[model samples]
Target chain A: MIVGERKPLDEILEMVKDAKKILIVGCKGCVTVCNAGGTKEVGILAATLRLARLKEDNPIEIDEMTLERQCDPEYIEILEERAANYDIILSMACSIGPQYISEKFPEAIVYPALNTCFMGGAQEHGVWAEFCQACGDCKIHLFGGYCPIARCSKSLLNGPCGGSADGKCEVDKEIDCVWHLIVNKLMKQGKLDQLTQVKPLKNWTTSRDGGPRKIVREDLKI
Target chain B: MKSGSNLEKLLNAGEFVITGECGPPRSADASVVREKAKYLKGYVDSVNVTDNQTSVVRMSSLAGSLILQEEGVEANMQMVCRDRNRIAIQSDVLGATALGIRNMLCLSGDHQKFGDHPEAKNVFDLDSIQLIQTVKMMRDEGKLISGQEMAEGTEPRLFIGAAVNPFADPFEYRVYRLAKKIAAGVDFVQTQCIYNMDKFKEYMKQAHDMGLTEKVHVLAGITPMKSLGMARYMQKSVPGMDVPDEIINRLKGVEKGGQSKEGINILLDQIQILKEIPGVAGVHLMAIEWEERVPEIVEAAGLLPRPTV
Candidate 1:
């Protein structure tokens, strides 16, 4: 799940103020689960835009469409014919969807309706919390399904630092110390001895520190 | 105070009221909508152009209301608080009043998960109650939510309306919520589809007891069930909808040829019962896809020529 929130209406209105023919495009992907960039969201944006334009007496034409997966070319190709009808495409899909639409329809102007936040899940109804960084590395297995890269302010790979007090992070008292959680899990599993071993320095270059990483799976390719 | 508008006159006279719902165009074409307006010109006292109804995007509700006003029909602008914040909501209300759309209905709106764009972001800046209060504040105080006075001292006057459901789960809360809205300065109320007259009568009695019968105008929302599947979906999927077991059984009793007729008849029967209720001000007919059948339903219920206040 991707955790995100909608941009303010005034900001969105400013973005597409001059667009006479606006197409509010929604995606049925990560954004849908997070209550953004879905068919319902597109309708809301369309209605709000309509009201805004009417208020200014600048009555603009609005058309709404939702795609299954906006990031996929196959899903986006379906909109090629309809793309020419609008002056601007307001994508309610995730950040990737707008980029894909721009890539596919180079001539049409594309705008993002939602602020792309982070990869996470719903903490509860109407509340979403970020839990992953997609750091191009898998260390959760060693730490019992918790990613310190996302949960910790320091992104420490080893045991709790002296800064951690009362199982809370030193940076933000509200946040729990990830290393503390890791130690508690290890102690419960009777593997506290694992903490005694000095861990090697992590290779920071393999993460986002290295610009634009790609994976070529020869076995999956046709 | 005698207003020049016929709608104002009707409201003052206390006659049986007439209200109709207009579905906004899905595209930019206004000709089709213009044609529909012609049918409702003299037939209905007021026409409600929905705002992104069911969370499906369409032509602007404000634009549609303006168009209806142009077509010589009184427009009731439906304003949903699903997408706009307090600033946009206040601005739109003032704009609608300036454009001659005096009738307004405030709604919390259906969640985006149900609409075509399920992934679109939702901005519930205010719920229906807060929206009503916002409008009242604007009308009474002539100021925005920030408590800033208008430069021109213009007051936005609206026949503010809100929605209620008699058949919603936890039935007492539904009635309590309506009371809260009325207290929040809602002048009128339009209920969800009335499928069960007995339940409606019970609800009406409670409303009367609450003294809402005199202070607020109550309109019964009547939507003619098109098919069995639609009825089933309304019962199962639509929140705050209650289709009684007897009505469902009656709908089932009809053969394939008579299903549509049976459904329409059931709606008519409900309206007939609703009209007899003492406190009901009018009927807000929502013919969804079958807008053409509204005149027939209104006529069948003996509500043609719209009673004046």
Candidate 2:
């Protein structure tokens, strides 16, 4: 799931200060689960903006709408009729939402209200942790079901660097050393030899180093 | 005879070599390197010029190594994966070799969080092991990391060294990490500073049993504690550093003014013990910021008149 957090209210107010008619759009996807950009958050933001504006003697019209999933074009297409009604459209979904909306309605002034953090799931209520780097190659099976590329601070492939102590990372004491966890898990599973085998230099071309990526599925193409 | 470096030659000839460290000054001063090199020039085989050790900005290891070479001292130029990518790393390798640097140490530098610039973005595009293999490829295969061959006789030839930590967590895996580094074409390794002798002995035994010692010369790291505060900070704060309670108690036993002398005595004991340990090839005395005392430490350890091969 794509986790996101709402931009600060002051920044949002500064952004929409010039617009009279503003639409706050929310997503029912991952942002909703993380309590970031759900319908309730959208209502709260709309109310807060209205109060902030009314206090300044400059109250303007504000509208709220929730989409099934802003990342999908089908849901974004529903706003075609009302897209031009507002001077500004503030997307409360992940960054992908505003991108999808702008791609569909090119003339619409679209802005993201939420910062898409990472592709991760809720570790617990109100807490989210990243678990994937989307590096186009997955080696978790060899690492005892942990993703070092996303979890390790150094993204080390061979083994842990000499900075971990008491199972905590040197970068932050609160963060668990992911390699320590991987080594312990592999040791328990009797697969420690997998770590000893020299992992060659990673082909970072599959990662962001290769630049913005795209997929072309001929089988699914019309 | 991969690099025919003095360090390599001494190790290959089965001599217990002594290596010292010279941290580049924070300011852009070549004379500071020259001054530090003066203390370690005749007292040790090669001096390791650190690359922004602990992430504090300093003179680059390349410039420091070049300065050491100009001072008629051999440099084990240290390269870290934190600040540069493969292109810069390869370019620096060529540049350093062109400047007659014969030794290189590959490392995954300390995280930037501990440095002066905590907000700095680290470029760990290649870790220590990968850096070792990359340099080895450039030196031996005459190929760049991109698999493109360099023109004839232009490849960098360097005696590659890597670091190992015997005190880091998952303690049993540290020896295996050394094996992996050796498999990656590292010719030798200098371990993290050793204070917990029991743990280091166990690590050495494992390496010896695995025949990793035969494959790579293992240089045990030695840092003489300057004060009780330094020992306490290393024990409680520094990761991967195992400063035992016994060591701290020993430091506590000494007067504040005498701790440095006590520290040297402790280092002498460790060096004597390290020499007898199987698979231990030499001692890499860090003596951080205490370069003036390196000659005294080397002499006390009976490593003077360093072998000239």
Candidate 3:
């Protein structure tokens, strides 16, 4: 799932400094799963912003709402009736939620309350490790379920980059070296020889490098 | 024959070309570059001018390389994709080549987080391997990476080079990565700091098996440890470098003030073994912050009287 964290209180306060009636929107998608922008987060943001405004002697109204998957047009259309009643929309979801709301309500000012981070799932309770770069191509099988393109510091397809000492990366000693993890996993499975084959230069055409990508599925189009 | 440069000619002539590095000072001083160049003068075939090495701001590698050129030492302009986009990189290539910078080594660079400008945005629009391919396109094809022709005689001729680290992880693939570098159109290869001789010998053996030595000049990189503290730092803290415990114990066995001498001897032994390796085309001695010791290391390593074109 996509991971994100709440924006700084100062920055969030500054965004709605001039606004009167604002829509505090949340998403039931990845942001909800990550506890970033969910129904509970929406209430917290609404109460916090209102308290801040009340303390400033300029009290503001915040109408809190949560939508099912803020990225989809059908889900976004559900907010059409109440969206026009606000001066701006303060989205607590990932970046995609705010952009979608803004596009649906073209005249309404939209702002994100969370900084969208990476595509990852929770490791423990609060820990999340990135496992994919969305390089648009999936080749995790080559590295025993690890994605070196996203995890390695250099995105080195044929990497480890002489920076792997023990099990840590050169960039930060605290961070585990992804190649080290990959090698250990492969070695455990008795597939260590697979690492000998060098990875070719990645074809960036499938990635964000080739420009905004789109997928069309003929089978599911209808 | 890309630039008919001294380094190119020496490597082509099959002479064991020795190279040295001169990291530009943080301040806007060309004299520091010249100061380091003077130490390497007549000791190395070409001097590598580092580009904001470790992501710290420094005098530009191009400007520093030009200073080396003025000091009568050939320059290998090092470029990293961390600071500039393709436009600025391409522009610098043409500018550096016009100023007589002949050798170019492409690197991905240490991440900016390691430097003072941790907040600065990185422009890794292309990685080191892609940059190598882009430079090759501009030189060999006389065109841009987009396949557009140069306006006239503006193609930048460079003896392309790239760096590889055998001491990283997944050790089996290190040699294959060198082969990939050769396939990326690199004319030469420099390695990361080598302390584990047994691993390096095995790496060289695989490189030779793949015939990489015949296709490109593989200069084994060696950084002489200054102390046990430095060795420990590189072993535990530094990335990709695995200093064997015996080397550290050897340094520790030396008297308190005599560690540096023992360190130099260890490096000298490594260089001697590196020379006997079948595929080693040269040695790149990176005496970081200890530039004054370069002449001594080269003299002891028998790399003096640097080859002329």
Candidate 4:
């Protein structure tokens, strides 16, 4: 899932300082599950902004609304009624929300209130760790289901690069050396011989190195 | 005579070769390299110029190797994958070759988090093993990584090397990693500094059993521990360095200033043991910043008067 976090209040306030009225829009997508941008969060932000503006003696008007999903055009159309009435539209969703809103309402000023982080899942109640780089091609089955491209610091295909100590990465003691885990997992599965053949150089064109990617499903189109 | 490098030639002739290392200065100082080369010029076979070792920015190893070569010293220039894409790496290989560098060591460079520029984005487009294969492709197959042929005879014929660590975790897999490197077309390998001799021996025995030693020359790495603090720092902080308790105890037994001598003594003993080990080709003596002590270490180890290939 796409994880996000709220931007610092000062920066958000600075972004909206020139506007007398703004709309705070939230998304019911990945940001909701991560507790970053949900309906409740939008309500809380609206109240805080109202209080802050009231204390400044240049009080401003604020409106709050949460959409089904900010990424889809169908859900974004819900803002067509009141979007033009405000000086600025503050999106509390992932970065995509502001982009989509801006694209749809070209004349309206759009601002992202949250920073989009990464595509990862929750590790604990308050902790989230990255697990995927979305390299577009997957080869996890080769290394006992561990993704070296996403997990290893060096993204070494044939690794445990001279820096694996006590199953931890040399980059950080807190992170596990994914290669070490791959080796041990393969060893336990009696597949240690699989690593003998030299893995060839990776074709990184499928990764972000190739630039912004797009996927078109011809079969499902219109 | 693959690359006709002094190190490759010495190893091919079955002479127990000795190579030294020099980290390029953090600034653009050619004299620093020349001054260090003077200390190691007659003491070893070829000097290995490190490429931003520990991720601290320095004068490029390409420039450093050229500088060392200007001082009448052969250079084994190191290249890492962390900073260059395959395009840049291949381009640099050609550039280094055109400038008369005959040897190159492929490494997955130290992560940038440990470097002076922690926020820098790393480009590990190819790991060390793939890097070895890429260099070999250019050298033996006379083609670039894209499988496109360059103008005839423009290929970079480098004596490629890689690094291994016998003391890292999942201990049983280290030997297989070495085997993969050998299969990837590495001509030789230099290991992490050996402090845990017992573990290194076991790792070497596994290589010998797998018949990996015959395919590639293995140069055992050693660094003289100058002080107890250095030893402790390596043991605790530096990953993959296996400093045994006995070594620490031995260092502890020494007086404040005598630790350096004790460290050299320990290195001398390691050199002797490394010579007798089957399939061991040479020693890559990395006297980190203490280049002056390399002459004494080589002399005491009876490896002086390096062979004239």
Q: TM-scores for all candidates?
A: 0.58, 0.96, 0.84, 0.97
TM-score of chain B of each: 0.93, 0.98, 0.97, 0.98
Return whichever of 1 and 2 wins on DockQ: 2
Q: Scoring each candidate complex against the real one, what DockQ results?
A: 0.02, 0.78, 0.38, 0.85
Q: Model 4 over residues A1-222: C-alpha lDDT tens digits?
A: 999999988998999999999999999999999998999999988888888888998788888888999999999998888889999999988998999999999999999999999888898997887788899889899989988988899888889888878899989988889998899998989997778777877887888789999999999989
Q: Write the per-residue lDDT of candidate 1 for residues A15-43, one digit (tens) a residue.
A: 99888888888998988888987888889
- Flag regions of model 1 displaced more than 4 Å: A1-222, B1-8, B151-153
Q: Write the per-residue lDDT of candidate 4 for residues B1-309, one digit (tens) a residue.
A: 789898899999999999999999999989999999899998999889999998999999999999999999999999999999999999999999999999999999999999999999999989999999999999998998787898767889799999988888878888988989988999999998998888888889999998999999999999999999999999998888899998899999989899999999999999999998888999999999899999999999999788997
Query: Which lDDT tens digits does candidate 2 get at residues B62-88?
Result: 999989989988999999999999899
* Full-model lDDT for every candidate: 0.77, 0.91, 0.86, 0.91
Instruction: Give the count of colliding residue pairs in each prediction.
Output: 20, 0, 4, 0
TM-score of chain A of 2: 0.95
Error of 2 at B62 (Å): 0.8
Poorest lDDT segment (10 consecutive residues) of candidate 4 chain B: B145-154
DockQ of 4: 0.85
True contacts kept of 3: 0.44
- Stretches of candidate 3 off by over 4 Å are A8-23, A44-63, A72-89, A100-111, A123-125, A131-149, A166-168, A173-222, B150-155
Model 4, residue B78: distance off in Å is 0.5
Fraction of true A-B contacts recovered by candidate 4: 0.86
